[model samples]
Target: MYKYDQYDQALVDARVDEFRDQVARRLAGEITEDQFKPLRLMNGLYLQLHAYMLRVAIPYGTLSSPQLRMLAHISRKYDRDYAHFTTRQNIQYNWIKLEQAPDLMADLASVEMHAIQTSGNCIRNISSDQFAGAAADEVADPRPYAELLRQWSSFHPEFSFLPRKFKIAVTASDTDRAAIQLHDIGLQLVRKDGQLGFRVLVGGGMGRTPMIGHWVREFIPVSQYLTYCEAILRVYNRYGRRDNIYKARIKILVHELGAEEFTRQVEAEFAAMSDLGLDAPQAEVDRIAAQFADPEYDAGAPDTLDRSDPDFAVWVDQNVHAHKHAGYAIATISLKPPRGIPGDASSAQMDLIADLAERYSFGELRVTHSQNLVLAHVRKADLYALWQALAEADLATPNLDLVTDIIACPGLDYCTLANARSIPVAQKIAARFESDLARQRDIGELKIKVSGCINACGHHHAGHIGILGVDRKGEESYQLSLGGSGAEDASLAKILGPGFNKAGVVDAVEKIIERYRSVRSGPDERFLDTYRRLGDAPFKEAVYG
Candidate 1:
């Protein structure tokens, strides 16, 4: 993990002091709710239906053990005893007091963390693959570049207030685990003729208008990445819609202008900025890269797991992922235990995770976009011990990409914008399929995402089975979609048919799954693959008929 320097510390300290003053003014009635909206948003504070909510950024989803412990401390002292990890790889505290927010911010700053850019219409947290440095198939670790962008875009005067919020993601592997195609700006690291470069994509987003990004440049040399990115942002800031909040995202601008003209404008801007010295220096890149050097490993550790215990074998199959090093594996800690709320980690659980990370993963952990945590560099020889510890803490659920590992938003339970509750739906579905391990394994690689609204915070648009909650005639109804994916084969899901009531939605999902089982070519064929092969007609008939 990258440590904060004097400059980084100073910047965060200043922001905390500024927000403390702002909070005091708002509480003292010196500023009205209307006047304090933007000020509070800039500090990552939101006035939800019940109480104030605070979102804290976990940059690129990486955290040190001390940082994790601090999060536990905040959860215990300030809000409720649990925190919600989000699809964006950030964490949210739902029950917050306005007067105590400054104290929370101060504690976060003490651990080199903050809530800046988490809620504002600015460049949000820069995200990357959870297994960035340790994955076996990666061409390069994308975190150094993500950190570079984080520093570059933080409070940049030019992009401080865009028409809408912007998100950027980076990935280096052929498999797009970061969901790059659904971001405002997606950067894929590539190698051409043994020289490293980037494949840039722009305008992709989900909200109301779902889109897979348009390819802007096939290749931009590593040296000129910053310049090219600046060009793209400059164009969007100048021409993106300002009249309607619904049409303000860069995706709308790209849709109206078409990819060809957008590419041309971006090229023109790049040409003009190329000679202005915006390119990042090689020395700076090397300096950042050095900060992420690999940890020391045992030279002669075994590569295989001990399958003596069937339970440990099940966990190993589900949670352990292949690593770049022979003796290492990436261990995913599931937040979804049987019927537990997805991504809700209690304060004690957070402390236990921190201790496990320190013991097994060099005091570091990464948060996954699927709302799980990763000990990205765990040694294979220590798998049994780690699994035992995680089991005792209720963090060892042997379901990674299965139907039970659901992605769900706070929904009506916490979010005022939501129409229905998502957590209960997720819990019901998980419990409905809890006992059938063999059946779930047979289902194979299914991702079910639930969102309470069209804001798509749960990333329902990218799930194999996407569920969206809507208000239909004063009753809570759920809409179902199929064939969505967030991997390298990124695509938005298609709606099935008429909406289902709360009681009926789960049955509809079961019907769809049964239809998939009946129609799939083999047990190995996933729900998304079967749907893609057969189209929506079969699934739609099963659900609506």
Candidate 2:
């Protein structure tokens, strides 16, 4: 977790003060709704269909136990008792009062958190792999880079107002847990010639037009990260479509200009900025890296891998991920309870996670890109005890990367742009496959993502099974997609024929899963492998024909 320095503290404090006055003016009728719209959005406040929604940034999805406790306190003190975790790795309070927003911002600032760049058409939160430091496959932790970008982009005069909301993601593993390919700018940290660098992907986004990003630069040395990033944004800001909000994302720019031409433009900018000394000093980089140093571990500790508890073993197999440390495991706290709202955590649950992170883990928590919480540095020996504690807290669901662990957005509940309710659909899917042991073994690896609209906030286009909600007249309908994946082998999901009505959509999903179960070579083979082997003919037949 990156601690706030004086510069960071001052920035947040100033934003809070600015927003405080803005709130007062709005309340006193000094500004009209139209006038207040951009101001509130810049502060991450949205006037939803029912009430004002405040999205607080978790910055690369990292949170301290104290910060988590503050979130719980805020949720309990203001708004509703629960907060929805978004795909951007943020938490949104859906029922915030307009009058209390300034106070809430001040409270968040007290915890070294804020809603800056959480909304509006500017550089939003820079996200990365939630399991960054703890994932065994990672070459390097991506959070420091994410934190660096956050510092560079937050309130940056050059990028304060862009054509559209921009998102950046970084990862350091072969597995694309951060869904980097779907972001505006995605960075995969890699090692080349015994030095760290990044594989940069740009112009990748989801919305009405969903396209997996194209590689803009390969092996960009880490020393020039901010320079190259600025180059990309500068090009986009200069030429990206702004006449229509629909065509404003960098993805659209990539589409119109083509990857080759876009690469040329970005390269030109990079060349011009090279001598400008845009790279942070080595000392600053070390400072950020030091903030992510590994915690002390007891060297001669007994391995906790031989635990006899079946549930604990199941959880370890499903929920626990490989850690960089020998004795540690990254524990994923699944928010997917049986029939519960996906990614929605009550304030009490949030506090419990905060406590567990402090006691069992390393006083650090991460909000995964999959919309789950993570206790990133739990010792393997303590996993069973952690599981017991989490089970009591209803956070011990063993459905990580499984069909039951569905990734969904807030859909119709809070999103005015949503066509249908997504939470209910996600709940129905999870409830349909509620067996723990059965799912742990049977489900294998599957990514099922659903979104309320074509905006693709839930990243439906990247799921093995993607569901998109559409409004046909007054009724809600859904379209199913097949073969989509957000990994090293990234590909956009293809739509499977006509859309289904609300009731029919669940049955459609059930039918697809049933077909997968029957046609799979063995239980160990994932749905994706089977789908790749057998193609969509069998699925289409079982689903539609």
Candidate 3:
């Protein structure tokens, strides 16, 4: 995990002081609600339907045990006793008081975390593969570059206010766990001919309009990526639409100006940037990289796991992933419990995770984009003990990529932008399938994502089965889409016909699962595979009929 240096600490402290004044002004009636809106938003504070929501950034989803414990304390002390982990790998506290927000910000600053850029038009928290450092097949750890970008983008003068919010993600793996293709800028760290660089993609995003980013540059050397990023943003700032909020995103601009033309303009901009010296010197990136160095591993640590216990074995099989080290495994803690809220972790749960991270993972954990937590370096020999601890707290649910592990956003229940409630539908689907554990397991590697609206906060556009809540006249209606994925093979899901009522949505999902089971070549063929092979016709017919 990257620790904040003096500069980082000073910047955050200054922000806290500045925000404290802002909050005081608002509370003292020196600034009205209208005046405080942008100020609050810039600090990652949102006035929700019921209360203020504070989104705290967990940079690239990496957290120290102390940071995790602080988050737990915040949830327990200030708001409700839980927090929601988001698709962007950030955490949200839904019941915040405006007056106490500055105190919360100060508390976060104490732990070297903040809500800065988690919201607003500036570059959001730079995200990457949660398995970045541990994944077996990755070319290199991507978080170093992600952290570099984070440092570069934080309060960047030129990009402080873009036409729309921007997102950037990095990954070094062929498996694409970070969903880079759906970001505003996706960087695939690559090494070619002994030179390390990135295969860059731009313009990908999801909202009302979902898009897979187009290839902007085949390669940008690591030494020049920052300059290239500046060039891309400069091109976007110059021509991206400002009149219509809907057309303000760079993705919309890229679509309007053809990808080839956009690339040409960016290249021209890049050529002009060499004289500006925008690229960081090698030493700076080296400094950041050193912070992400691998933890100490016992060379003689046991590689074997005793899976004699079927229940423990099931968890190990489902949640544990291959680590780069032979003796260590990456264990995913499923936040999706039976019929429970998808991403909400109680304070106790957070504390337990922190303790587990300390005991089994060098005091560190990674938050997956799918709303799960990962103990990235757990020893294989301690698997059973870890499983037992997690199970006791109801954290060990053996559904990693299964149908029951649903991803859902804070829909109408919390988000003011939502037309429908997303939590109930997710709960319904999980509960429905969890009834028959074997049947659920039979429908393997299925991802069900639900969003309260078209904002796609839950990444509905990237699910094997996607559900979007919409306002139908005056009632909540759920729309379904099938065959989308956020993995290496990225594609937007296609809608399956008419919207359904809450009850009907579960039935519709059940019908699709049955259709996939009936049509798949074998159990190895996933729900996504079945949908892609056969298309939506069979699933659509099964649902609408």
Query: Which regions of candidate 1 deviate over 4 angstroms?
Result: none
Per-model TM-score versus the true fold: 0.99, 0.98, 0.99
lDDT scores in order:
0.92, 0.89, 0.93
Q: Among all windows of ten consecutive residues in candidate 2, which has the lowest summed lDDT?
A: 435-444
TM-score of 2: 0.98
Look at candidate 2 and give me any clashing residue pairs: none
Error of 3 at 437 (Å): 2.3
Writing each residue's lDDT as its tens digit, candidate 2 over 116-142 gives 989988999888898888888899988
How do these models rank on lDDT, best leading?
Answer: 3, 1, 2
Give the per-residue lDDT of model 3 (tens digit) for 1-545.
Answer: 79999999999999999999999998999999999999999999999999999999988999999999999999998899999999999999999998889889999999999999988889999999999899999999989889989999999999998999999999998889999899999999999998999999999999999999998898889989999999999999889888998999999999999999999999998998878878778898888899999999978988888999999888888899999998999999999988679989999999999999999999999989999999999999988999999999999999998999999999999999999999999999998888676787788899999999999998999999999999999899999999899998999999889999999999999999998999999989988888888998898889876
Candidate 2 residue 415 C-alpha distance from true site, Å:
1.5
Clash pairs, model 1 backbone: none
What is the Cα-based lDDT of residue 425 in candidate 1?
Answer: 92
| Residues 21-45 of candidate 1: C-alpha lDDT, one tens digit per residue | 9888988999999999999999899
Q: How close is candidate 1 to the true structure, as a TM-score?
A: 0.99
- Higher lDDT: candidate 1 or 2? 1
